[model samples]
Target chain A: MAHIELKNIRKSFGLVDVIKGVDLEIFSGEFMVFVGPSGCGKSTLLRLMAGLEDITSGEMSFDGTLVNALAPSRRGIAMVFQSYALYPHMTVYENMAFGMQLAKSSKEAIQERVEKAAELLQITPYLSRLPKQLSGGQRQRVAIGRAIVRDPKVFLFDEPLSNLDAALRVATRLEIAKLHHAMNSATMVYVTHDQVEAMTLADRICVLRDGLVEQVGTPLELYENPQSLFVAGFIGSPKMNFLNGEIASKFGANTIGIRSEHIEIADRDGSWKGKVVHSESLGSDSFVYVDIGMSGDPVIVRQEGTRHHNPDDAISIAPIPGKIYRFDAAGKPLKH
Target chain B: MTLDLWTITKRTAFYALVVFIVFVAVFPFYYAILTSFKSGTDLFRVTYWPVSFSWDNYISVLSTGSFPRNLLNSVFVASVTVLAALFLAITASFALSRVRFRGRSLLLMTILAVSMFPQIAVLAGLFEVIRFLGIYNTPWALIFSYTIFTLPFTVWVLTTFMRDLPIEIEEAAIVDGATPWIIIWRVFLPLLWPALVTTGLLAFIAAWNEFLFALTFTSSNATRTVPVAIALLSGGSQYEIPWGNIMAASVIVTVPLVVLVLIFQRKIISGLTAGGVKG
Candidate 1:
């Protein structure tokens, strides 16, 4: 494990700047996740840390030692790409053992490490098989296995689960969570646009917007108290609803952010009232979209269980106590 | 059911077209095989089918002055040319395709432009360079020239194929502690076998069939390649050309290429069209 710090790091491709200036410190053995919408420079930031992309200007140090000029391998970082990126011609064993073999490790050591990684990933049975023979999920495991055998100080995942089916994504996500617990000492920085993955997997989530750090906190901290309107919306699934104009002005704010689950279906005295426009019953929860006549568009209110409301049915909704978030004119959160 | 007259006519015409095309393409090689096995007056006759069978022409061509030596010279030159071109192209294409840099497209376009120049336009200039290098009349002359000539096509094709390789694979290799050279040899090279095979075979065929430079560069039979030797195969006098011996030599030279292409026919076809469509 290493302490990674980026001081005012900036990355640009000629004219268009991707990562403007980001300063972040990742603690030893920290599971730091970078999450944002597409093109927010989250992947670029990850690449900068992995030494894949050169930082335009800044100090990047691992464990108090500057690693700006170090090659990727020398930096002791292993990255799992969105695409598995396994050597297509090589068998799973060779793919996993390639890095060690390049370092000229002994044959026995190489095999031992490879088999260990394979066992950890439950891919020992497929070690002798070429990448083409494996399915998408298996191939990703092999890719991760390849990374594991390296035993790097830092483990970087660039959306490793993005390329799988829904069922496989869930299965692999669980496996990754277990993997983090299994390798607690290795600092991991994962980059993904999926906030659910960010919420579930991250110890501390860094929300990026336009190459800048919008906010960095634990998943719940971001959910409960977002510093910016972007984070308030980006950190939650079904998205945090924003009400503006008269409804927000009533609270002396430009916009008010409320998470779907945080809003309740009121019995009689409710802050907002509207007819149910659309609803999705996902067994455990029902996401009912209400056409509340607020300045904002239809509000998505999460209700427990299935099929609680239908279209043309009237309902009153209100946020739970002081759970609603207020934001001013500049999208900066306004604390009451 | 009885076949319709129109269907029968269309089928007959299609078969006739196919026969014509095959005959047009294969008649010369077929005739060479036939002529290679004939002796004496039969060489004069216009025989489509084998009227006589004799190994006399083959024996003469093989045993006669320096044909075997010329064959060896051709082999050495072509193999060297193909190997040199492919080795250089593999590394160059890796950089040109995989590594982004300033003026990459400009550089690639310049290479494409250089290859488009007519070979005859540079024949004199190339001859001078060959002589200046002191490789003229040696197999080195042909090898050097052919490698330079083949580099553009090989580089272009290989670069296209190399570009198609997923970038993440290269990044993964980088994280795995592979230098560019290691990645090329171990990672990109293996995935690129089919493309290499295709380009390598094409380069071999080009080097093997090359004649203008070969004839101009070498004066002695020992240094001359098979194509030049075959062209210069003559009888006692100027008027009398050894057609049978030429055909026999042609047959011998062509068999190896035919076998090579046949063996790697799949790879070459795929290689030639590899970058045209997404894999």
Candidate 2:
């Protein structure tokens, strides 16, 4: 296991800088996720850590050893790529055993490790099939199994689930969480554009924006006390609603953000008045889009159980007091 | 009834064009085989089909003189040249296509430009080098010269084919602790068979049929390849050429190439069309 640290790391392609400067530390045996919008350099940061891309300038160390110049394999890291990147010509068993085979491990050791990994991923039956013959989900499992056979100090995933369909993405996400628990000694750095994945899977989520670390905290820390407005908005699905102008000024701020579930639909004397614009029901819960005349775009309110909030019906909503997050003009949250 | 007639007319025209093209392409080889089976005055007649089924020319070509030796020389030289060219090209193409260097495109262009020059243009210079190396009048000289000419095409085709390979595969290999050599030998070589077969076959054919260099390089009957041997085929006297013996030798020389193409026919077609689209 390795504790990874990046000090003022920067990456550039020609004159265009993708990762300007970033500093972060990931503990040993921790699942650190890099979550951000596209072009935020989340994937690039993971690549730098994995030694797939050389950091233009900075100090990176794994367990107190400088690893900036080390090759990925030499750094003792195995990466699962978004495309699975399985060797098409090799059978599933061969694909998993390849890393160990390259290391010149003994035949018995390689066979044992490959078989164990295949069984762990429930891919034992498909071991003899080529990568092309397996479905996308199976291919990705083989890719993970390949990484597991390496038993590296660190594991890196670059949007490994993004290529799968919606249902498979969820199933594989659960599998990965179980894997993290099983392989508790290995540190993992995962990169994704999906905040839901970050929230559910990460031990600590590192929110990146425009090549900078917006915030790094536990899922509850990020959800409850976001240090910046960007992290508050980026970490949650249905996006945290921002209220500006006169309403925000009353809270002694330039902007105030509140989550959909934090707002309650009131019968009367609500903090904000609006009309129901649309509603979406998901069996257990329903999200009502209320037009509060905040430039026509609706503020979504998450309600438990199904509530028939029909369109064009008058509605009033109020933020649950302390749940509101206040931010200054520069988007940094004001101290409570 | 009218539609049926039109369909028949179009089908007839298509078949007629196909037959004409096939006859035009195959006539010379067909005539050579026909003449090889004829003896004496019967060979002079422009017959569309065989007049006799005689084995005299075949027996003489195989049993007498250094014809069999020359055939062996051609096989040895072509096979070695194809193997050598493919080995060098596969390695060179990995660098040209995968590894980024400052003047890669310029280097590739120079290689292609080298192939553009006529063989005769470099004949004198190559002769000096061949003599300097002291491989003059040997199969090594022919193998060396053929590799020089074939490397450019093989490398160019292999480079394009190698470029289309997913970089992710190579990266995965790297992460698996594969050295560049291992990647080439284990990972890439398997995937590269179609392109290799295609390029190797073309190089084999080129070396097998190459007459100018073979004629200029080797002097002895034992060292001479089939093309030169066929060219230097002697008749009973100085005035009359042994046309039948020459035809029999030509058919013998061409058979191996036909067999090779037939065996790798599918791979060659796929390899030729490889870079044209994603496989």
Candidate 3:
């Protein structure tokens, strides 16, 4: 296991800067997810850690040893790519055994490690098949199995589940969670744009924006106490609805953010008046979109269980006491 | 279903065009085979089909004189040239296609430009180089010259194919502790098989049929390749040419190429189109 540290790291492509400056430390045996929107350089940061891309400046150390010039193989890291880059010509067994074969392990050792990894991933049945012969999910499992056979000190996944279909994505996500538990000593860095993945899988989430570290915290730390308006809006589903103008002024703030689940449809004495626009029922919960007329966009109110409110139904909405997040004009959160 | 008049006419025209094309392509080779089987006066007749069958001409081409030696020279030169060209081209392709460097596209263009020069334009200079290398009258001279011409084409084609290979695959190999050589040999070579077969076969045919360098570089009767040997086949007198022996030699030389194409036809087709588009 290795503890990774980045000190004033920067990356640029030609004259265009991607990662300006970032400093963070990943503890040994931690699952760190870099979550951000597209073009946010999250993947690039993971690539830098994997030694696939050279750091433009600053230092990166794994286990307190500087690895700026180390080759990817010597970095003691294994990476699972977004595209599941399995060697198409190699059988699943060969693909898993390849790293060991290159390391010139004993033939029996290679076979044993490959089979053990294959059984762990439940891919033993497909071990003789080529990558093309397997489905997208199976191919991805083979990719992970290959990494397991490497038994690296660190694991880097560059959106490894992004290519799978939605149903398979969930199944594979579960498999990865189980893998992290089983390989608890190995430090892993996962990159994804999906906040759901960040919230569910990461022991600590590193939010990146415009090539800079926005915040680093556990999922609950980010959700419950976001340091900035960006983190407040990004860390939650249905997005935190913001009220501006007179409504925000009454709350003694320039903007006030309240998550969908924090708002309730109050029959009277409601904080804001609006007309119901539409609602989506997901059986377990439903979200009703309300147009409060003050905010340009409709406010989404998440309600428990199946709930129905017809379009144009006049309603009053209120955020639960002390639930609103106040932000100043510059987007920094104001003291409660 | 019954065929209408227009359908019949369209079908007839299509078959007619097909027959015409096949006739045009195969006529000369068919005539050579026919003549190879004919003896004496029958060789003079312009026959559409076989007039007689005999192995006398083949027996003469194989059993007599320096033809067999020349055949061996052709085989040696062409095989070596293909092997050398493919081996060098594959390695060059990795650098040209995958490795990032300054002046990469320019270097690629320069390589392509080298192939654009007419072989005759470089013939005299090549002769000096061959002589300087002290391989002027040996199979090495032909192999050396053929590789020079074929390298550009093989490198260009294999580079394009290698470029189409996903960069992620190479990166994955690197993370798996594969050196550049292992990546090329284990990961890339399998994916590049079709392109190799296509280029190797083409290079083989080019070297096998090449006559000018084979004639000029080798002065010894024993050292000349089949093409030159076939051209120099003589008759009983200075005024006569042994057309039967020439046709038989042509048949012998051309058969191997035909067989090679047939065996690798599927690979060649896939190779021609493989890197042209993303899969």
Maximum-TM-score candidate = 3
Query: Candidate 1's error at A190, in angstroms?
Result: 0.6
Q: Comparing candidate 1 with candidate 3, which one achieves the higher DockQ?
A: 1
Rank by TM-score, descending?
3, 1, 2
Q: What lDDT would each prediction earn against the true structure?
A: 0.90, 0.91, 0.92
Q: Candidate 2: list runs displaced more than 4 Å.
A: B1-8, B268-279
Model 2 agreement with the true structure over A220-262: per-residue lDDT tens digits: 9999999999998888889999989888999999998999999
What DockQ does each prediction reach against the true complex? 0.49, 0.38, 0.47
Worst lDDT run of 10 residues, candidate 3 chain A, spans A263-272
**Candidate 3 CAPRI category:** acceptable
Return whichever of 1 and 2 wins on lDDT: 2
Flag clash pairs in model 3: none
Give per-residue CA lDDT, model 3, range A119-223, as digits (tens): 999999999987877888888888999999999999999999888889999999999999999999999999999999999999999999999999999999999
Cα deviation of B261 in candidate 3 (Å)? 1.0
TM-score of each: 0.96, 0.95, 0.97
lDDT of 1 by residue, B155-183 (tens): 99999989988888889889989999998
